[model samples]
Target: MSALGMQSSILVGGFQYWDSRRKGRQFPARGDLDPLIDIPRLVPHIILIDVRHDPLDFRFRLIGSAVRRNLARDYVGHWFSEFPNYSASSNIWPRHCAVAESGRPMLQRPTYVGPNKDFIYVENILLPLSVDNPGWSMQMMFLEFISKRH
Candidate 1:
């Protein structure tokens, strides 16, 4: 069960759309993602992550406008592990690993720790992405960070 207070229909809808694309496969590929240009309201809240491995890294691929503003910074091109959320032994790390390993979606509540240890209560969803010829290099993923703050 999710610890989130109230779910956003937009987030739920986006997950459903991505889930639908799987069609019994491991996960939805990047090519299968919708443009999201159709939903202007959601554009600023969505985030995309790349599930990289070797040491199991999660890279920030896209940091939406609203999230960027809420976070007071953008992390695109940066590694999720650098942040407190994905730090070793953190609740979020294991759940994210589960999603990467099982190729399933996981909804988890994690307190995001920014620089200076500022904590933001957030609900995050993790999804896998793969290509026909699945490999780490092509293993993209999705993550939605819905902050309860602000």
Candidate 2:
């Protein structure tokens, strides 16, 4: 199994507690809740994709503006290959695929290269979203800064 596969398994197993806690609360649909109400509650930079599609064709359906600003562009609807480096795509896509395929979540700390190739550490949560569609197309992601100084 890939490193991401191992991480996905661990995250899924650990999520039992998280799910239970969430169930105890009442979180409405995204449309029903205020967009800015709990930005911190869900880390915003993480990327989610529709696993049923080719990773090269997979689009990010949801993204936070904070993430967009950090990225400096609209990454939603873009392919992972479009990222600055092939290393970034290779490092992230497999783990993303592992979680989506297993209906599990994966925690990843990815480094993004900023201006002048400065690396920024982003802690991310990749959550699988099971929709009724036959293709099983969807995933949710959350991201936060592990170190602002990065």
Candidate 3:
């Protein structure tokens, strides 16, 4: 396997272990993921969403600086649809929605086209979060770039 593929596998494995340990409970809320508090062994890019709203209403509640540099622009309050054509936003949106609705973790290995048509491999994890809200419409997504060498 390629280096990116290997790294992606490791990340997926880690997420799987974490998921298994959760034992069907919902992921913690945004405040629970505070930088000063939550320290992940692998510093992946984290994103939170509120599925109660429109899919187009999804936002990035958290993102690491390293991940931010690879993205086209700031995505703090923007929907996934706001991403440029190079970003493969459309392909990933549906999967994200499914993960939110099912309240399950979804892992994806997608080739993202960055600025100037540069290609980068990204391993993303969409973990469902069940807040006190009625419909279990909250979710937290974590993205870890395998590497930028490719």
Candidate 4:
């Protein structure tokens, strides 16, 4: 089983890639990943978030095409706090906070609450990305959608 105990091949693959990049460090630097050259097929489903502190907020550094299509908006360069329906008390925020603070991979299975309710849920792997400094990092998120029954 993968570190996150997930069975989805896509999630597993993403985890494997992130794990491989670690070398010996607890987390890999953002510069370590090149979506086009390394994970081309999974590129469209990836989202990169910039972690900010002194209040703790997240910014959309990069939103993949597939993710944008599903959300029906391109949120690149926007903060998560600016998104509609976003609340600090929301269930999603803590998951992110945990990963950011702990520098660990987290498996998230959140039901579809976006524009399209036809999807049953989404499988997401949030992997922490570190720089040279401590307490400063980004998050690499990989997602897969599951459709609801007819």
Assess each prediction's global lDDT (C-alpha) against the native. 0.62, 0.52, 0.58, 0.83
Model 2 has an lDDT value of 0.52
Residue 12 displacement (Å), model 1: 1.4
Worst 10 residues of 1 by lDDT: 137-146
Query: Which parts of model 1 have CA positions greater than 4 angstroms off?
Result: 1-6, 38-40, 112-120, 132-134, 137-150
> Candidate 1, residues 15-120: lDDT per residue as tens digits?
6666677888867677776646544566676777776677778777886676676564678998767977556567766776777788767665656654424445
Model 4 ranges with Cα > 4 A deviation: 1-3, 132-135
Higher-ranked by TM-score: 2 or 4: 4
RMSD after CA superposition, every candidate: 4.3, 6.9, 4.9, 2.0
Give one clash count per candidate, in the order shown: 0, 1, 0, 0
Best by lDDT: 4
lDDT of candidate 4 at residue 146, scale 0 to 100: 76
lDDT of 4: 0.83
Error of 3 at 138 (Å): 2.8
Model 2 CA deviation exceeding 4 Å by range: 1-48, 53-57, 81-89, 115-119, 148-150
Winner on TM-score between 3 and 4 is 4
Which scores higher on lDDT, 2 or 4? 4
Higher-lDDT candidate of 1 and 4: 4
Candidate 3 whole-model C-alpha lDDT, 0 to 1: 0.58
lDDT of 4 by residue, 49-91 (tens): 9888757888888877777888857789988788655446788
Winning candidate number (TM-score):
4
